[model samples]
Target: MVTTAAQIGWAESAALIFRPRVGELLTNTVLLVAITVPLCAVIGVGGAWLVERTSLAGAGAWGAVLAMPLAIPAFVNSYAWVSAVPSLAGLGSGVLLATLSYFPLVYLPVRAALARLDPALEQAAASLGRGPVRVFFGTVLPQLRLALLGGALLVGLHLLSEYGAFALIRFDTFTTAIMDQYRSTFNGSAGSMLSGVLMLLCFALLLLESRARGRARYARIGSGTAAPPRRIRLRGWQLPAQVGLLALGIAALGVPAVVIGGWLAYGGGTVWMAPDLVPTLLQTLGLALGGGLVTVIAAFPLSWLAVRHPGPFSRLLERTNYITSSMPGIVLALALVTVSLFFVPALYQTTALLLLAYALLFLPRALVPLQAGIAQAPQSLEEAAQALGRRPLRAFFGVTLRLVAPATAAALAMVFLAVAGELTATLLLSPIGVQTLATRFWSLSSEIDFAGAAPYATLLILLSAPMTYLLFRQSTVLSRADASAGPAPATSAPTTAETA
Candidate 1:
């Protein structure tokens, strides 16, 4: 870690920043993040408010439907758009793809927070003669600040690291540029130097995301029970609200459907087939399954330590894991590649290295939900089992682990989906001649072959749907389950991962 950080501060990093391509890359990266964050927040917060404070029928259904986009990888989403419309093919395409794929970052937390928000505060705001907007922006929004910020932080950070989708859209962001440097000039000192600069940019984003931590996280997601918020009848505007939602959902979801449909029709084959499909499919599945399992396994110790130990060291370790996960995957792939060539030469070009990179990059997505699961297990129950002569491990498994089982499935689904859709690290570090759905789509799109890319692109989105469903379901389960429980007792709230 020390050496990696130092490399970013080295003179080579200065040269990296001054290069013209580097500037364009950095600008595009910033634009992607800047554009996506607010868009995600709007979608999440709007949906949350609708479900929690409006009279929309079947709101629970809407919540699930709205979050469905999380299933579609941005690259898949981008292809659907560009392939279908061909006209929406530039900056606007990048923004749309990013927003559609990532809005759930905001949706998950804000939904949880809204479900648990205290109705009295908003009632009090309106009782004081504030308009609905005023009440929401003032009293309600302040209380939801952490959730909103945290969700936006995730969206922003994810955007910074995004690769597959942006590349397909013909955009050049930092992750794209870094991949180019590697593929075009793998051993060139210039490529490594550019990667070093990317690491710096990723580090800065990590720092900015950290600022949203204590300043935001007012309550744990999917945990705690507060009274259902009173409805804010959109008395005069109900029709408009429904119309707007329909339009938004259509725009977000429809283009991809049409594009994939047309391509499937025109090709006279399985929407799923490519001549190289089977090998790539097996490789993609193998890596996604392996990485998901590995990440979950790695997170177990950290989650246990953080939830059970309750110490500064454990806390620091957990935070470090998140920080590392927040760093762009491109940076991680580069860091691992750099390590392989210099320190672990035998591992280069091997499957083991690629899996390790996946584990490092998506570790937090695995950790957060798993930690929430562990936390939902009451500490007292574990203590009681331990006191009855059960071994600690036995007690945890016999008691807490059984309850947290659903969460494990959810975590695995999320990590697996993320790994499946990932493009940058896989592009940079996979064995030569390797192909996954991601690289398959990437190669075709790179050659401006949108028609050829369509099948892989379509499948990636279809593949993501199940994972996204599981994520929303698990998040909802955690929220509804815990909403009855309220916050962990203040004294026990700091439980470390070790104790469980």
Candidate 2:
């Protein structure tokens, strides 16, 4: 942060603040966020309600379908849309693409909150002559305040950092502007100035979200083991409800599938069998696995300290880690470059350095689940194992580790998928000759070789499919745990880190 701040002089900052170009970028960014965030919230909250609270058929299947969009990177979705409809390449298209791709961030957490809500409150409201809508607004929405705000914060932060989708749509924001500035004029002050403004925007978002989240507790008290929520019978609206869900599924997941399928069918004879395809796929997988393992291992100690030994110092350490996660990938990559150049020249541009960058950027994804899991695991269980003559480490493995295994696995998969889909950081940090799927696709697409890029995009989606499924499945487990144990403390959801 100090380095970034130092890069901007008062004159440069003033110029950025007054420049028409900067104003245009700011307007475009605010417009995108204003349009996208609410759409995500409505779709996410409504979808969660329909799937989790209503007597909708195939609720489980619908849940999976709704959450599947997280597997499709926003850039891939933008490519799909732009390839099919060249005219759809601007602010409107950017907003639509991002909303479709990122609503799942809101959906997952809101759905989990809905799953864990004590249905008794809603039931009470309904018995007092309230309609369903009234009951929801009056009784249920208040409980969702924290989840909704947190999800919206994630979406907002992502918009601030997003580059790929916006860039493909020909829409420019601070992120894209920063990338362009850097590309055209290496380490330019204009880029740093834009980054300073972006950082301020992020800090404002963090402050607003924290204030909105408030200190109110959503946990249920005096619970006699709340019964499963009674699903609201849709009755006359059942068929329409099903159709709506089906449409959402198709809209979010279908467009990309069809676009990629068309590309494969048209170009497969030559490009499908390319030799580099296999190597790139393997390289992406290796990086993702290595990065995921290293990140999780690095996060364990911090998460443990936060959970088991809560204090101001531990909390500060955790918060300090997240500050980097909120920064754009390019900014973080540049910071790494600067530090490595001066102090660790041998590590510069090495795979180890690249993996370290991934670990730094994605540690929160690993830490959130780990902290939650550790918090939920009973101290008594570990004590019991220790009483049985086991060592501390052995007791942890036998008891706490077993208990948190689902969340641990979820963290690993989340980080793995994140690393696989990452773009900007990988672009800057990868070794001289290394080409991951994301970079390869970006390269081909930039050359307007949509057909050639199709295969990499397809494989990226295929690789993400299983991890996405694992996320949804583990979400179910977490939801169940939350429901039975009462509302867990709020933690930050994952944020996207990119720049156009």
Candidate 3:
């Protein structure tokens, strides 16, 4: 982004930044984030609390339903809303679409955190004469700091960088403005200027998340099994809880299903038989799988370095990846376009280049889970393997890697889902004549051919659904295992892997 901006003279850059359009976009983006992120956090945290910590009816079913929004991309959600209500266009619509789509980003993680919280802490607080609300506010909420902070950070970044959802609603954000500017401006100077401002916003988010995270450690240090959290009895609140959850589910998940199904029925078999459908689906899956694999491979070493070799340098490198991933996809796409065109002409507009962009854009998605998973894999286990005549490399792959398999799978699923629904980057970097599900959906939807877009949108949702389930399942299972599993016996006894 800086390099791109440097191409223009200072006066041109100033003219770009000082314009009225930039201010409007800046205000819209800031207001969108301010409105959507808090709503998402509230819905996410509250829904997670009700389902996981309270005796909400059908808690298990509710868990899945709360996470269902994640299966629908924000753009698809926006498409559904626009179809349902033709007048839905503006900041209000943007906030509604974004909150519904992104609250799950908060809900899933917070729910998983709630599932793994130690009941003993709450019990202790209650025993000290704290009321239920007091116990929750003082004990449980504090324990959830990391999950809440991470979820909010993700929500904020998504709101900042999201393109299609806002674009569909005629709501201008930095991303949408950047795309427009790139298309019209000479050498993309104006677009690059907008991207620079957007990057600064991303950096601000990163810095805020860092400060909120502080230097506090949330890990349990002792060697004892944690008791499962006891569900709080809702009592008089059960009906209200059920009502709130039902409304949320209907808003977030029901809208898309109904709209898409209506469109499918309207279009009938002919739409399904579109010549591009199969090829587009295949290409979407192929890219998603390839990008997921590449991103996971790229994240593994960084995760390992962060987990096994903790230092200021490692932390800086970790933050650097987050900063990269937080930028609007258009920024990364344009940067890659510039680099490939000037330095590696052969790589221009190729699958490899696109995959590289994906890796760069979604590395943090892959890195976060890998770091958590690797951190949980005891270093002693690998050392024990080394003692058993295995090489260090072999020990890590054979011992530590196996332990973090679930997390690795979760990471892969995350990146896969992200790549499957990616819009701006894919639109720019995908090879000529290549159309993934996202690009196809955007094209048809933009042309007001909702019926033709429905299939693509449906396919995108289907592609993400199982991955969403996997993410929810893996997070809960891993967090519970970490909470319940006692530390290795401090004896000469070999571990299970060693014994096996």
Largest TM-score belongs to which candidate?
2
Tell me the tens digit of each residue's lDDT in model 3 across 1-500.
56655777787789989999989988998999889888988999999898878888999899889887888988999999999999988889899999999998888878877877767778989999998899989999987777887888889988888999989899999998878776666366777788889888988887787777666655555664476677889999999999988998988988899999999999999999999999999998899999999999999999999889989998888877766777789989888887888789999989999999999999988987898899999999999999999999999889999999999998998898899899999988899999999999999999999999999998898888897887688777877786677444334322111111
lDDT tens digits by residue: candidate 2, 1-500: 45544556566567766799988998998899889999999999998999889999999889899999988988999899888888887788888999999999888878988888888888889999999999889999998887788888889888888888888878999989888877777664566678777888888878777777776766655553557888889999999988888887777889899988998888958987888888998899999999999999999899889999999998888888887788778777766776787679998889999999999989999998898888999999999889999999999988988998987887888899899999988987799889999999998988889999999998889888997887788778878886787654554532222100
TM-score against native, each model = 0.86, 0.89, 0.88
lDDT accuracy of residue 377 in candidate 1: 87
Q: Rank the candidates by lDDT, best first.
A: 3, 2, 1
1-500, model 1: which lDDT tens digit per residue?
34643656657556655878887777777777787778888988998888768998777878887888776677777777776666765566788788887787787878877766656667778889999899988878887766777677777777777777777667887777767777776744555566666667666755665554443334444443367667878877788778777776776677677776777677667535666878888889998999999999998888888787869997898877766777787777777887898799999988899999988888888888888899888999999999999999999889998988988988898899888888888887889878899888878877877667777877788898776786688668877766666766333222211111
Error of 2 at 458 (Å): 1.5
The candidate 3 region of ten consecutive residues with least summed lDDT is 491-500
Displacement of residue 407 (Cα, Å) in model 2 is 5.4
Instruction: Report, for every candidate in turn, its global Cα lDDT versus the true structure.
Output: 0.76, 0.84, 0.86
